[model samples]
Target: MIELLGKNLTELQAIIVEAGFPKFRAKQIMDYIYKRYIFDFQAMQQLPGNMRDWLTTHCAISIPEIVTEKTAPDGLTKKLLLKLSDGNQVETVLMKQHYGNSVCVSSQVGCAMGCVFCASTTGGLYRNLDTHEIVAQVLLFGSLLKERIHSIVVMGAGEPLQNYTNTINALRLLHEKEAFDIGYRRMTLSTCGVVENIYLLADEGIPITLALSLHAPNDAIRREIMPIGAHYNLENVLAAVKTYYEKTDRRVTFEYILIDGINSSIENAHELGTLVKDFPNCNVNLIPVNGNEHIQLFKPSRRQMEAFKNIVASYGVAVTVRKEMGDAIQAACGQLKVQHAQKQSE
Candidate 1:
């Protein structure tokens, strides 16, 4: 099926001309897809019956198929298991905030970056998603809500930088005024320190917020948890992050997951603070590790988390404990679709 969702105006125009329709008709279809967020061709009453039939027959306004949706009791978070055309499932989340609705999108079906603590990589890599599929996830959720999405976080099942081309293209399509109309600044891309992509992102200068999954400050601990750290190391990752800040004039966000006695000690906090001391503009986002029944790990107590934040704060590093979302439905940080998939297979 032909996917019309990811096409820009020019591409849509070309499709219309090729289909023996007037070029102006493409603008109408674009308006329906973007401005109206209409997925079913029948909803577009302005189009002639023949054109609608033709477009519906030849084109697919594709969106992710929801296999299941689990809404947390808080009513602000919904976790979805989406089945792609190939029958491979990926996760996307709709998070309701006072600011507005925010959606998190996955770049690949599964992840190859073997971050030991993550479930996305436990299944190993399947394949990278196309630009169309990535955009479809956003369009699927945004269209359903009928409200503008205020933010996007590319911190889902896969490492976004590993799928850089498609991720960037999807970002561009999502930010298009004719599409989801999300601004570039509202988007955040999280990476597990894929050093080269940091440099590449700096060259592009898209002005999206950069979130480094710096679960640990030193190379030793990071390497133990994240396989990528073995190759790039903490020093290399920080260097690239600094380069990114130098080029974009934007502060990087270091995501540190407080895995109960693993990387949550005061010593680690001091080390993390010192690591960011030179980069005073950078901020630390402390995340409480999300655990499951299979994993005996536990989330840190409120006091413990606060102590870590205060320790970093004392070093003059701006830091905040990231608010946990979808906890009732087990949607905390890495506990979304990944854990579910593991449960199903077992």
Candidate 2:
């Protein structure tokens, strides 16, 4: 069946016209699916019975099944392990914040970046998810909350830029007026230095925030943890980020995961501050490494984290430590999915 959720109005119009229906039927269908959050054609009472029957036969609104869900003790963070049609599961996180609700969606079944501290790459790369799969993640969470999802972070499970086309298409789908209608500025796409794709995205003129996973200060230290840093070094990645800023004027966020005694030293912080100090619009987000059994990395002490942040701030660069949330539930990216998979095997 054709997955209709990810298709834009133009694509939907083509599908409707090809299926022996007027172009206007596409708008009607979008209204039912997006505005009403109705997926089943049989439930769309406005559409004619014959059209509904035809839709039921030819199209499907793909929504991932929630195989497992865990909510943190704070009751503000929830993570879902969603099972796709082919049985591969991807994790999506719902974070309830004082500002608004945000959802973190995964772009691929498993990651290929091979970041040593990440749990998503534990099983190696599986495959890039289709646009529908990516978009379905947001819709699933949106439907569950029955409220607006204020922001979206493409920072879960997989490398979004690696699945470039689908990631872009999914973002567009989510931004559509008929759909979630999230503003471009509120959406953030995190990449592990996919320099070419970063350049391509800059050319695309999308106003969304671009976040770089710069776990370490220099290439030597970065390559030791994140293999992708070897090919796309910090210098090249920053150049691409400069192009992105010039093109979109959007402030880029550098995600620095502080691993205890590894990348959390004050010297490392100073090196990172120097690297980004000249950028026109940039912010450094320091994240203490989240615990994972598969990875031996440990989070730095609160004093260590604060001292490191102070050094980066002293370089005349904007820096902030990311607020910890959902730690009790293992809400860190890829942790829940990995644990769930392990349980199934046992």
Best by TM-score: 2
lDDT of each: 0.84, 0.89
The TM-score that candidate 1 achieves is: 0.94
State which candidate has the highest lDDT: 2
Give a tens-digit lDDT track for model 1, residues 137-208: 787777777878888999888888989998998898788777777887899999998899899999996888
Cα-based RMSD of candidate 1: 1.8
- For model 2, the stretches where C-alpha displacement exceeds 4 angstroms are none
- Taking the tens digit of each residue's C-alpha lDDT, what string does model 2 give over 1-346? 8889899999999999998989998888888876667888999898889999999998999888999989998899999999898889999999998989999999998898899888999888899999999888888877788788899999999999999999999899888887778999999999998999999999886799999898899999999999987798788998998999899999999999999978888888888888888889799999888865457789999999999999999989999999888888888888998788788799
- Candidate 1 Cα outliers beyond 4 Å, as residue runs: 333-346
